[model samples]
Target: MKKTKVKVKRLKKGSNIAVISPSNGLASVFPHIYEMGLKNLSEVFGFNMVEYPTSRMLSKDLYTNPKLRAEDIQRAFQDESIDGIICTIGGYESVRILEYLDMDIIMNHPKFIMGFSDATTFLSYFNKWGLVTFYGPSVMAGLAQMKNMDQSYEKHLKDMLLKNNKSYVYKPYKQYTNGYKDWSDPELVGQCEAFYDNENGFEFYLDDEPSEGELWGGCIEVLEFIKGTKYWPEPDFWYNKVLFFETSEEKPSPMAVGYMLRNYGIQGILNSIKGLLIARPKDYTEEEKEDLKKIVMDIMTLEFNVKDIPVVFNMDFGHTDPKLILPLGCVVRIKPKENCIELVESPYTNKNK
Candidate 1:
């Protein structure tokens, strides 16, 4: 039998959250946006925020000190005062810090650690070793702009992090923004750009049957960084996994995204996974999205012949406004006919446990 995945206690009001910068030190550069996010965590979520040493370091300084970044994560888990951990923002080349992480410390004291984009490196790695990790908004990106978006965004974050729900059903946001406004401009610090209606919540391509699997995956571009590294999951890890993927703000072309999918097909991953959850590609035009959908279907159906697994597209996660918090290692059920995706297992252990 497979070893049981370890889960950490859920966060509550007044919980002390450790903020760290394992990726780029965007906190120092965009203090206005970062501070707004921290403010929301305090006033809105009722959490006490604790900043780590690397959370406000300069970008150049942080880039030169990947060891320091990894050390921050190590110390956060080791510190008894910290109830949970959240990232300042995502940045490129977080893979550099992976070498410095001590998994013994992280897995032993697994608590909530959430971030998306470049943070995928450590989040996915931690989950691979049986510790549940979160893939969601960071301080500068999603959290800062929470108040500007729909109120449901705040509720979703709280439900995932604070509440102990037996089963949670995910609903698509009525509207979403591709990205945020200029972070440097103090006037638009916490504001997002033009919003678009989410006409189709989730597009189901191969939903002939329902399936359940442990949720795994992150930004598709970030996953590419650890493809052949030890951080990459073993070949057997693909079995019964619902792999979720999305693009970054960099916005690779449809053909480019298809190339990445083709790689998974080549690895025989498409043949083993129970379901596939794809997020809306950031900043893609409507025409581009249709093209992406076609290419994805062609690759999975024609080339890989993966017919049984349920495939969904345009999910509300990754580099998008009002994102959902997806817990890696949690088991989720995908029902195609019902147009539903539900988290059947609680990702958190009781606080006293």
Candidate 2:
């Protein structure tokens, strides 16, 4: 696959961000939360956010409707004033919209795009096209936290997207949350799930040294769904990449994770990539995390016959609250000895450069 031109530029204060619903539009389901997110993007983050044609159109029908979602994305990029794009939130079926995407349009008018979970479908796609797409935060998912923001998340995101900082070292969340109260209840607005301390930091496995590469991969569930589709890339495409993986709220079992890793090994992808970075699974017990680690390691080493692949787990990103943004295709150094992930290059280029 030939790489497309990368036109991603750093976002500045007051950059117009098109809020599009490439997947589920929770904004339609919970209008108050959506409005709150819009307010924060404007007032707190100093961004000019614009809603596209179907940003608030919620339903399985529209989500499955590829042309509508694709048009929103195309329009967002075609609009000269829009500097970035954000998904309203993730859902079960973002892959459905891939066929309708005008890749020529996306390639010709590249811009920053942000979202994760099912949004991974687009994140990985754009990365393969050589455009930087973020794999963290969404309107309904990350913004609108009541009364407080995760200081680390806010700073890192601002530094990269708003300030154009090139260097960063990731630190584990001092506290993290996987708890979710029902969003259907109006009283739960701006409410946070219970949080517990994450004192141990990243769990380094295999070779706990350092590996540098552009980041790849996204939500495992979405990756599985898109496999063998036109959107899926070859093993050679993953060469010299630091692949990241996270489970969605669905939280498949440990055995299922083994199968996914095994499939990668079968495709000869495991040995080709430089490293692996796994997120703390949503709502998993400590025991389950350990189990997952063992399963993946066993398959990669014993079953797949690959060794010293450089793996890390329990990083602070994905479905969890207070998650960090990872711009796919950005250069990052995964240093297990330092217990951190470091950005080596700004994820953006100058507009005129």
Candidate 3:
């Protein structure tokens, strides 16, 4: 039997959001970007930003004490006043904090929790426990750079986080940037690097027919860290799910990404999933993107003999600027004829009641 999903309350203008550094303590290292993100959450989103204990702790201290990081997450969930929780930034070793987390406290007091990249560890785990989690944006990454990106991004964030729309269609941004300019430069704070035209919003390699499934997945690299651990989902979890994945700024080569996807084929995940959504990689060239897609198709069709599933590439999420938030456990539909993706259900339990 499927577990009933624990829905969170809708966040409004005055809602209080707890900010934590569950991953790398980049907030302490780069206070400018972090502070700018908090400011945008306040001025733009109208959120009351509350900083947790680990939000600005030193990187060395945070790395040495995973328990402390987990405690901050627990305390935030325990706090009734906090309407939601967001990460300060993403780090590589946040998986270490998972063992120390109190699942009971988290599941019982389910509220809004959003992050990406390294956040995949807890977000994916929580969804497995039947709690909806968000895989989009962190403070220093997406949020801080918001003011400098397209207005569509700000609208997208507000729509996903604030509005309780029964159905929402994701529209690709008019433009995109690979990454931020420089966090350390006072003048360059909150500015992205170069901008590129989003000529092809969402390219579909396979769209035999429209399909719908619960949304799940995160940074592809981050998912690898928990593959064999207790936090990894069971073999049956992939069934009837739309798995979304994206690469980070590290820019794993096309061949490297192919190896990762090949593992999914081996695990029978490619056959089990309803559809596959690949976000535009952080800093890949046009040729590299084509190579990645070809490798993915080869793995699914030639290697695994699975070709019916809908495959979408270059989605506007993950490391790209002007992100569209994807809520895990929410049902989303892909309409081949319409060439569009739609969130078929409201992620929140309240539904703006």
Candidate 4:
């Protein structure tokens, strides 16, 4: 997979942002949140939200229709009016759509596509084709909130979508939610997740003087699961990149985390990257945090034999509420001395729509 210098266009006010379900049809299971998300996308974000054939057509086993999902995505991209694409929600098997996608159509017509969780399947796919994708929020869980969207989360999202053509720097705030309320509960229509304070900032490792590169990687479990699949980038593709990965609500044990890193170590990926931006795992207990950190440090030292890799862990994103919108393949700087992470290049271009 030879790579090219691929840049994508950004979103603008009133631009059509197509919403599609790339994985599980969570909307059928939770219609209220889906509707709320549509309303929010229109009234709050001020975008002409459009849905394709399978955006909200939910089912238990019906999500296996990868062709439908893939076609919806292709159609969304082919639609000239659409300026951005947001996945409806993440599911268990977004990888199924890989074989069905029209890669030429997608690569030729790039837009600001953003997702996470199972959508890592597609995020990594587009990125491999040299198009920058986003690893961030989805429709139901992020755009549609119970009471209201988090102020910080919406601001960053808008910053990226509305073409803030400058180096973007995200600040550390002592507020975030680890999980969420049940979206299926009809009684909790106006409720959101509770916030927790005392959440630590991004912790540095091995004296992170400064490291910079384009963002790579996605949900750790998904990355590990998709390993050896065609979607996983080659070893050369991992070189000189800032690997961004986070765990999900599944809460794989520290042992599992160790094994995953060991696999990366064996693949020479651990040594290939300039730095790691590890997101705070979902539902991680305080004790488990220290335990996981020890596991990572040990693996990097004893097994991988690559110590002193610059790392900034415990940052907000992944399944966590009020997450940051991170653009894959955008040049970013991790400055440990200033305790700051900033984007150096504008991720957006003033191209066609």
lDDT values, one for every candidate: 0.91, 0.81, 0.91, 0.79
Location of the lowest summed lDDT over 10 successive residues in candidate 2: 144-153
Identify the runs in model 2 with alpha carbons over 4 angstroms from their true place.
Answer: 1-7
Residue pairs in collision within model 4: none
Local accuracy of candidate 1 as per-residue lDDT tens digits, 75-108? 9999998999999999999999999999899877
lDDT of 4: 0.79
- What's the C-alpha lDDT at position 24 in model 1? 90
TM-score of structure candidate 2 = 0.95
Candidate 3 per-residue C-alpha lDDT over 197-236 given as tens digits, one digit per residue, 9 for 90 to 100: 9999888877569999999999999999998778888888
Report model 1's TM-score to 2 decimal places.
0.98
Highest-scoring model, lDDT? 1
The local distance difference test score of model 2 is: 0.81
In TM-score terms, candidate 3 sits at 0.98
Question: Candidate 3, after superposition: displacement of residue 237 in Å?
Answer: 1.3
How far in Å is the alpha carbon of 113 misplaced in model 3? 0.7
Q: Model 1 shows how many backbone clashes?
A: 0
Give the Cα RMSD of candidate 4. Answer: 1.7
The positional error of residue 154 in candidate 1, measured at the CA in angstroms, is 1.1
